[model samples]
Target: MSSLTPGVSRLSQPPTTAALTARSSTPVAERAAQVRFRRAISLMAMTLVAPGTAQLVAGNRRVGLVAFRTYLGILALGAVMVVAVALDHGLALGLAVNTTLLFWLNLALIGAAIGWAALFFDAWRIGQPLSYSMGHRRVAVGLNGVLALGVAGVLLFSAHIVSVQRDFILATFGDGAASDATHGRYNVLLAGGDSGAGRWGLRTDSLTVASIDEQTGKTVLIGLPRNMANFPFAEGSIMAEQFPDGFDCDDCMLNGVSTWAQDNPTLFEGSDHPGMDATVMAVEGITGLEINYWAMVNLEGFKELVDAVGGVTLDVKDDIPIGLPGDEVTGTIEAGTRKLDGFETLWYARARYGSDDYSRMARQKCVMNAMLQQVSPASAVKNFQGIAKATSDMVETSIPASEVDTFLDLGMKAKSQQVATVSLVPPLINTAEPDIALVHRTIRAAIDKSEGKQPAQTTKKAEAGSKAKADTGTDAPPTSTTSTTGGSVGSMKDGYAANESEDLATAC
Candidate 1:
């Protein structure tokens, strides 16, 4: 009993200095670890809130200051740009299209991204994560690494997009000043050219002048047939001086003007795009509108562009051939509403077999209208890279890069409105012997109708014609005496006419 009591007493006695020190140091170590964990968390939070602040507070002052200043400067510049865009769109567009500026902007973005990422890493290093628990250290490292990658990745991607846009702008548009609207409208000549092996320059196969109202975006598509002859040139143009009378020589059709200019380049000395310039003058004279700009799309390249956007949906009305003229037919596009790829859409716009040029022109107008209506802004952004590449490869335009935003706005407005079309062909205006005065009158009426300046004619003759068609179960021919807006001259089944209908879709 005595021995057991002593053993118990010894066990219950006060601890030694070594044992006490070990027990006390355990708690001290734990507290130190907690303090380090809290510091790391605070530093990471600071870095997230203000990118360089963590480094400024703990790591490297000079690096932090430079990064923070750059960040502030970029933010300020962005705010200014947003305000500028809101106030003056043209100025914003001008800056966006400036290649030299874009290049520097890209480099700046890359530098900022690298600097910001480095700052994050430095902040992580300064947090002394090694002194923390395994879990806490892992979390800190993960957050810092993710932030660094995110910041760098976003800016680098933005730089890439900007670079693509810059390249596209440089490739597609020439150094041409934006032209002023003439008579409250911007008359733009759009031509589709075929660049075959033996062709001299590109043949202006498809020619249309889109006369757009400056305020309302109301448009009138005035199509001139490639086969039209005896057309005059705009006054004071070199073509006018050369062909003093009309282009009345044998085989001197409207489209031939381009080839002629190309062949006789000396005749158009000092002109950069002699063929395009001459063609523009001819179209201006025929339509009685001053052209603000001209854009020529290479048809073959156009196909690639369409494919790049995935494809275009078009309401195909008839069976169209897909082969060169007088050659064995390769395929047939069945008639229906379908989404067509680049090649198919190209044929839809250019097919001529078992069809005449006049009909082809009407189909082309349909293609144009479909594209205008379907290509929304969201889709454009989503497919921007592909579109940029395609546009740069396909189109050559005198339109300034500064004016692109303006046109985009106009196009958006135009999409909401009905597209009106007028073709200078067939029984309405004899293409072989075009009456210049009548052509001008037809164009003006179409424009007026489109702008709502003039009421579209709803003739009793048209109602009677409809009734007659229903009664007879046969399509009624367009009445000769019909006094419509542009003068109803042809049925869709027969051939394309100058004054088909106020609404092109309805006419077709």
Candidate 2:
């Protein structure tokens, strides 16, 4: 009312003490906000660097201590595993294959992930993010949520993968210790079985003994014709006792032994795998080497395994037929170097049209060599899940889970070495009546050659034939002759038919 001086009015007065206090406090509020933003950032960083540190410093001590200890233990275990893997791969594999250990480890991973996520949430609470300015608070929440989910999600996913692998191993392998290697080698009998309609049990079509050196992993494959007859069983085996005079029945062949044993289960009583056991005895008697373990690959299932590894590449030597017996020919696999799918590979290995069993055996050996050489470690790791599924579905083995690591190591070593093969076919040994003593001597010599103790001994016919071809400067006409050693000579040009050579690759 007294504001008649100049332009002054009662409504327009200067700032009072309270209003000034508020104005001056604006800078202080801004400074507080800045400090809070920094604190929020630092707390999140602490949680990231070392989970539960904020809880230890400002929140619940018990939860913080537990989480911190667990984190430290996990780090320690990871470091120890890295060191162990670097020092001894077999030790790492052993731990991986141990189902009990894998189960506990998977559980620990899940638990740790949950505990770590809880610690992150507690850390955010300890930071008092809600007390901060809106911008700072939002940033803090976002970061905390991200970190919690990220750490927990990754660990949970890894746990799932480990669980899958553990289940696969547990389901696939039986409980037993690894068999002992004999004569500085482990002889694994690899048989390919066909389960067609009306085929009683599994009719083993391919028989090969992979003799692997215990130390160097140098391997020799000894292929036996499925038609071989009049063979004795391993001296102390049940089959040997039953047929002391040898498997000499008029209609009984080597491959028939498995079916006969299955039909007459009482003959192989107390044996869990009577068919495979009987076949193992026949193989042992024929090869004259102890069979440490046996694996039968279902040929139909083998296709899946091949496809799982992304198909195998091989040099096809001849046009192979692809069709069932007594069925119309679907197609023919043209001869060339090509990558083959599961179906094509199966046909390539099992085709009997325009070929005999001996030639098929040679082709199978080539397939085995190609697989061993071509499946690289990188490719295997990339396709681990598919390969695991295929192997579990296709293969039936007596090899135990505990021995997986040792065999894995040996397989890796074997990959670096050359594979030698010896097939006892028509020109080498008569399948009608195999010379048991001569078979033992030949197998021993092949093993010695593989170990570098002896030279490769080519047959006289092969030597003479090669010399005649060289002398003539043209292909020698095919001829057959009965030898004094009870073997029949045949053409070597026809895809290693009834021929034995030091190098299977060149022989075929």
Candidate 3:
């Protein structure tokens, strides 16, 4: 038997070959049917989810639910196809179209929010029940018409909502937004102070420095501890200096200066220093960056801004217990991602309990990052109205109205880039006692380093000049400026850099 060739044995086993062929064919047929069934199921599921005939069965009136559903179906299908093409081929054209459609849809929804308030209130619907008593139903019909007209009027007048919102967007990221090269390059100081709501006094409780670099397209955020003292006032003066002839009264702490300027408008004329300008200049002096502009917003504005954006989602970087008014009202936020409404976001920014101002600044920056993420195109589509309203009410900036277009262009261009953050930690700069003189020195040195300017000794000159001016109200000559490297200032050491900015380098 072994001598017989293998081919001769196969020739004798044709039946086996037939059986194997049949078995293979059967499985192929079965698999084909299975694939068909899966395709059918997928189609059915899509139909069910779509706004279509099913909507008519759901009993929606006024506008035909079926038609509305059909429109949504078209929108959804288009979005799906667009996304698929974009992903599979990285088609810029397809993405552009898809984004445009989404933008329009978002705009429509925003418009609808203002226009459809009456629908929620039932004012646009007929007041009378649908019945056979037709002749007298005219009253209800008339009433409905009047209500609809009123609602339309509201929508017309409410147009400012979106405009204000666009303005706000312009302020933060800059106008045109598409070309935001300066997105994270410059530093914008955010302050949380008490203002409005019957109490008009303003004092910055929290200070945050946001740095955005246009060349690097990175954002660096640093939060300073409010308690860290030794802020430079004049030369020997540990407290704020008296007002210069043209400057506002410098009697209060840096935080209180804005409020003082607001009250003494005459002295601070043409100088909004008591408000955002002064704060910005001080921050510029400390950081050594020429601040482009500043925005000042208080608690009331903060709440309003957050509320307008509906709410923002945030990642809990650490466990923080927030105390509310009733009892020891406390909330422990674990380290994770969570959705935060306006009130909670506000609380997160303003929270100081069991945390230092440094911690608060970190939280504030975190919240801001989260906010930028939330307002991304996809999320913006879902919450345009809220975002628009919040932006309109909460933002105040010095960016010119004419330059909004340029800012917007910049913003849109840099939308997808990574955001960078910068902070001056210990070894570079650290907390110290509230000695105005020491602070001035450190600040001057930092500024000099940033500007590539000469580092001279000015601490003693500043002190002497400050004392002489305090006594005689006379200004110091450029030659009288104290040396910062090794100078005599009462008993303090001389390490502060010389004041070089002649325009603003005057000691108190």
Candidate 4:
């Protein structure tokens, strides 16, 4: 409406940018309302940085005091955790593997999330948002929601991560007394399981004992050929009781020891996995090293694990076959330095189409070494869920839940150390009639050499050369030649190049 009085001007307010922005005609009541609205917004924002501050200044002082104290306590706890971790780097690993503690931590996170969201809501209420203009009120609500949900969402996600770790630990490790280190060493049996390590009617496709120093983390991977025959059993063990002289039965091989024991369950009456027990006994008898724990991997699961890590990098020496010698070819992983996917990696480790058992064993060591070095802690964390799922699927272990942190630490340390391998195959220790005394001395010598206790034994003199001469030997390494028997780089008469390596990394 136009002004009727003389010299009257416009009645409507100017644009928002012009209103009260260096103005002289603005009303006191309207300006006061604006000030209160600004004050309300300021209080809400204070709660975002310092929870309960808004309530302390304007609403409930007691509630604000409680929330503020709780917040301070949490901050102090976090600081303490940081200091503890600084002192002991393995402290977080302990917490991660501890299922009981993880359960509590996850619950605490959930509770903290709820409490934090509640405090944000309280701050919004204390802002007196209803008294503000509708637009201001909407802004206040939106900002309050962002703060509340943002913190809660982060904490909720943390809780979920904790839950995943707890589940993986619980599922993988069993409740048992942790095996103490033997002579300052932890010897764990690594095998490929057709069924599972702890189940009935199982046979190991591959076997390697990962003997590690408890203090230095130096490791020796002793690869036992699956076809090893006529081996003695550890004294006083059930296998020894059955075959006092030696396991010299017709067609009896090293891998069949498990199946043989499982057939006569009465011998291992109280044992869940008689086959595994027998295999461990045989391994102990052969190596003279005490076995602490065992881990078995399913081939299918092994592929998944490799895939989970994005793939394993390998020095593919030749065109590795994918299927058995007699079977039609499924695929081939060509020679040269290549990063192979899960399927390709699995074949690289297991393919025996043209390769002999010993050659395959050599390749197995290569894969193990690659995994130990390349699949890093960072990668594990980055692909945490995939790795966890793959690990649980493919691997079965006898390691106690308590010892997980110890192995986790040891594995990390092992990456920094030189990994050596000893394979009891042709040209070193004959599989058909292996010199039992020589085998023991060879293994001990390897371990001793690794520990700087003794000098390395020469290939001609030693029964099982500690050096991987078969795979990466001086004579033109394994390549596509007439001498290349099967798919591997060496002939059947001599042995596979990978059968033994002084440093597995160099051999592969």
Across 66-85, the per-residue lDDT of candidate 2 in tens digits comes to: 77787788789889989989
lDDT of 3 by residue, 1-508 (tens): 5766666865574467878998899878666655544433332232234322222332244333544454577689779987887675434333322333444554664555443433422321222223313433454455445544555555554544444444445444332223232323455676666766654336666565644445432344444444443344332211234432212233444566455556656644565445555555445444555556555555656766566656776655455556643447477555456777676777766665554444454455556566654566566646666665555556556654444443444454335444433233222235443333444464444334343457564544456778888888888644422431111101112211111222111110
Best by the lDDT measure: 4
Q: Candidate 2: deviation at residue 244, Å?
A: 3.5
RMSD of 4: 5.5
Model 1 collision count: 0
The C-alpha RMSD in Å for every predicted model, in order, reads 5.7, 5.2, 19.4, 5.5
lDDT comparing candidate 1 with the true structure: 0.79
| Alpha-carbon deviation at 449 in model 4, angstroms | 1.2
User: lDDT score, residue 197, model 1?
Assistant: 72
TM-score of 2: 0.84
Q: Global lDDT of each model?
A: 0.79, 0.79, 0.47, 0.82
Question: For model 2, which pairs clash?
Answer: none
lDDT (Cα) of model 4: 0.82
What C-alpha lDDT does candidate 3 achieve relative to the native structure? 0.47
Q: By descending TM-score, how would the candidates be arranged?
A: 4, 2, 1, 3
- Which candidate has the highest TM-score of all? 4
Which model, 2 or 4, shows the larger TM-score?
A: 4
The clash count of every prediction, one per candidate, is: 0, 0, 46, 9
- Deviation from native of the Cα of residue 174 in model 1, angstroms: 2.0
